[model samples]
Target chain A: MPERSRAHEWTPITLLPLNGGPDPARLADSFLTPTSRFFVRNHGTIPIVDPDAFRLEISGMVRQPLRLSLDELTQRFPTVRRPALIQCAGFRRSELARVRAIPGELPWDEEPVSTAEWGGIRLADLLAAAMPDDAARHVAFEGCDDVEREGRRFGFGGSVTMEEAARHDVILAFEMNGEPLTAEHGWPLRAVVPNVIGARSVKWLTRIELRPTASENYFQRRAYKLVDRAGATTDAWEAAPAISTLPINTLICRPRGGERLCPGPIRLAGYAWSGEPGGVAAVEFSVRGGAGWRPARLSEINLPGCWREWTAEVDLASGRHDLLVRALLPDGSAQPADPAPLWNARGYMNNSWARAVLEVRAD
Target chain B: MPERSRAHEWTPITLLPLNGGPDPARLADSFLTPTSRFFVRNHGTIPIVDPDAFRLEISGMVRQPLRLSLDELTQRFPTVRRPALIQCAGFRRSELARVRAIPGELPWDEEPVSTAEWGGIRLADLLAAAMPDDAARHVAFEGCDDVEREGRRFGFGGSVTMEEAARHDVILAFEMNGEPLTAEHGWPLRAVVPNVIGARSVKWLTRIELRPTASENYFQRRAYKLVDRAGATTDAWEAAPAISTLPINTLICRPRGGERLCPGPIRLAGYAWSGEPGGVAAVEFSVRGGAGWRPARLSEINLPGCWREWTAEVDLASGRHDLLVRALLPDGSAQPADPAPLWNARGYMNNSWARAVLEVRAD
Candidate 1:
């Protein structure tokens, strides 16, 4: 029964589920996955929670320590809904597998992702109610999940400066897909930090603490680190800072490799995303490996934190071709041409230029 | 009973309802209303539709006369959803009331508008299936509603050239707000041409006829026209082409006229929209009329056919201040500085600059 419940908790990919995790082969579909079908990454067991009984406790360096029920929170403050994309820092970990066998953790291909409409009360409202001490600088969130790293065990915890937490669209979400939160999906409540790494969106949220220093958890401090050496392992996790907003990335979602398309006007569609609040600045696609590029018409409806859908109509010639898709950030940073340059020991944060090969035939 | 039903149908506001018919205000609380809450502007009675029995017949200059049911239409073709803003050409007709007592239809003050997520099959897909003949020039849509105008009777009808209907994102929407269309708000299905005038979104869609000419209905050719005459009773409707995409416009939704604010940093919020598919190019806010203007931070999420939310933080001193907001389109057109220049006999298509006055208190 427990295994059956776990199976139900797992979201299935309808078109093409990642075999072991995510892989480059899955790039044929448009990168934007419907909210229900997005991949989930869990550091610990999913907790069962009751919305009526949920209480988010605010304590530590503050003038007032308060515990508010979900009902009280909703009625006392205004609610805002924003679209945001939540991505794991270790997305595309499968690229490291090609370099060398890194035994540990899920051999995540590239599926560590999803975007959703998050509606909730702002964390700033809670801070206003708590009245943090003048010296307090960091706002840390502790989740109910526990994980072991190396030989030490700690709760899944993370923190950001108080100033970062006060941004406009940050929220505590209690729903997904217009329904109440489900177990394995942060049942009662979860944090939704738009344009930030998914690790910061602590699920099964239990407590929020305002402190003068950053979080001291193993997961927050020692794991999820990216090192410079490709094959070298290191205990220098302390040196790496926690990931925040995602860098620019693009994925070609249709016309799989080796697929034949009759020569004509073909509508190309895909998704582009960035962790920055400004959204994707630009997306360019090339049919002949990096030879010629054209801009994709971006969807006008850019919901904050949600993926932007893009489309372009191309007149394909009868020939074998390799297609490449790349994205740019508002700051002008682009995906690297190859994944080899970003290779790291932990196999985290792989945002390389994505490519697909196809054959075009005469109509 | 009729009066009670009328009361339920109309949303009362400070300005008189246009056309001496249903009230323009909606019951929804949000600043932008959902499709169900949007005011319907029909020149004819509501058309009762049977969803299961309904058939959208495509004929005339088409190579094939195709009849499709709701289920078959949705299942056979891909579905598309996009956010679109629909506004009556005479949204703020009551503003003309201040200049002169020009009696007009739908004395709408600030209502007669809304934005909604429309989902359905694309008109392009249906047109592709029908495969119009080489000489087919225009596509005409006739609604089921029956009406009498200028001593002539006809069904609500309109048409766009084949080139116009083939544009991307033009859809035949059967659902709004994730639900089936409501009775008064065009049940069964309706045409939604993004970035086009409200009249083009013919409701109660019954038949689509491919023709070689434009629509000839009174509403299509005679009514909803924009003429340029200064004197009272001069018809401007015949002078200008029928209204389609909205002119660039801005609305002051907060800190309304005569409102009071405290001296300090005041946040200004409003909505701006453009009828062009390119969307709003820029929006500027002026605290002291047009002395010095600052660009408001436009909504990063630029959804097509939807209004963009803009905000600006301005420091205030203790005094009275006149606030003005104006929008610019991609083509460099702006909302006229004065409403008088755009006023006409029917008082339609007013895109005057928006202004609000407020006083700031030191305390």
Candidate 2:
């Protein structure tokens, strides 16, 4: 269960699963997105399990199957905090949808992406207690929320390799921003896997299963792949690697859209991030309709798995303008200037240059 | 001193230093660029160094300075063969020049790049014999050729991190394609530093100096950097990173422009390469302007420091067409679509989508 950014500020992209987040303009003002401003990305209904009755079951390819109450899980392991970003696979799918229609998927704009401090018990300690078998290769998680998709009923599920699950930052977070988790954000328990698509961070989590293979959940097996054609054969879906790391991306948050301002020098702000070990090196912004790009100064040093804020100012004469932003990766690659090249069946990784249309009015 | 590619077939971009390579269409016909067709990128006048008098001096931050004659370099070290690609920093500058003027620099058009089998001794073996001190961080290289610029005459020089220079593949190559090197190709000896810009390879090897910092040579400190403005301040040049690893790039060699073919299905071929550890993951091509892109089939599994050949076909129905190719890197980034945003004072790393135009007419 994920919490809404703000009661009125939040706009639901999907009502059935209650998926939504705060506006982009609201995201530019702070180094860390406030807990209330964190995006909620749900694939199913928010589960309402009580903390007293909540029991996280550890089973599958482990030598011991243990059930721990919330108190036992919190007290047995030392509490630590990790600040990281959570971005939906379709964070900027709307831009892609403009190139080609994406049916049956939410047209996410610059929402469903935010950073926050997560306090929790390290998943490695819990996995060690369970005594995972040597044969175990993947750690699969199942949330309590009921997801009814493709005319089938099942709990939301996903997985990560054992190597990733054992990482120090991967945790079973019970608190966010120093407060107990809200119902919408996996109330009593949840799993937070950093530097990956948000779908793998199962919210309202209750089950942790270790297996010799990846989880067979539809989300992990079929939905998250970068398939090019619609209704691809099963082999195509299975052969395609599941989307793991997100691309280096940037978003223009200020002047979110359709804004009128007096002509003159105006400050623009945004955020850029990359899941690669070498995070975003630099970001450039253009107000000249892709004619030229200028570097934006970044504030705060970039931390591993965290996005950095950037700002730039440009003088605008009275007129309409299409502002664009793109990130430069350490590999000497930059985000594409057009979206048509990035369009795919699922609209995943639409890291094409982001654009915001602005109208500069004379005083 | 470097032999021209079949004389009539080679078109010298610059006559003084003798810079040129075979037409790219000749490159796509073979996986390995023929030794005679290998690109010659010289920054100065090739020197006529007699083999007996050619001494490669290894000094600077090393415990013991050692000078080895050509005979000693060969007799003391075991012979090895390594296959690698050598790409000029201005391989596609002509493409960028189309978007913005690039004065003075050669307008390279898919030339100045090639691959060949280099036979020589591992640079690591020489470094071991020289015993570089702990304080040594960079390995600088200088050639026997004479370069004149800034009212001063000096040898062309550049450097790489000691870690990169010590790679198993970096070699002091004396043979190309199992034959003695031509004077044009650094007859006595040349250093082949794999995966870096060709500038660092340093033709006509004369010196290897281990240093506490990067080489102060004009090419290393100022010329090969990615400066945005003309006559950049010394501080700007010092702060900017010298062009090192080449970007993931693709070029269409088939139908090498100005082709008029009968309307029908036509084959397209090219090469794609990246300097990243995780090589080029995929390459996509477009025949419909920039409307859509299709995956191209790559041949000969990619090897470290080498480029892979790719081919695709599209139906052309009695009209003009602009074929384009773009490479996808493992970091989830793609070659940019337009060159306008990549405009810089020196047209370095213009990895925009490569295009080749054709006029398909009816008989």
- The alpha-carbon deviation from the true structure for residue B340 of candidate 2, after best TM-score superposition, in angstroms, is 1.4
Tell me how candidate 2 scores on lDDT: 0.83
Per-prediction DockQ comes to: 0.02, 0.01
For the second chain, the TM-scores of the candidates in order are: 0.86, 0.96
If you assessed candidate 1 against the hidden native complex, which CAPRI class would it receive?
A: incorrect
Could you say which candidate leads in lDDT? 2
Query: In order, what is each prediction's RMSD in angstroms?
Result: 26.5, 21.5
Estimate the TM-score of every prediction. Answer: 0.51, 0.50
**Chain B TM, cand. 1:** 0.86
DockQ result, candidate 1: 0.02
The number of clashing residue pairs in each candidate reads 20, 7
Tens digits of per-residue lDDT, candidate 1, A1-363, equal 011122321233331212222332332222223234455667765665656777889999999998988788777865544456777777766775576655564666556666655556778888988999999998889877666566766557888788778876678876654345556567677888867678788877879999998887666676666666544434566777666667777656666566779988877766778866577878888988898888887654455566776678888889887888888888877788888777777777778877777789876
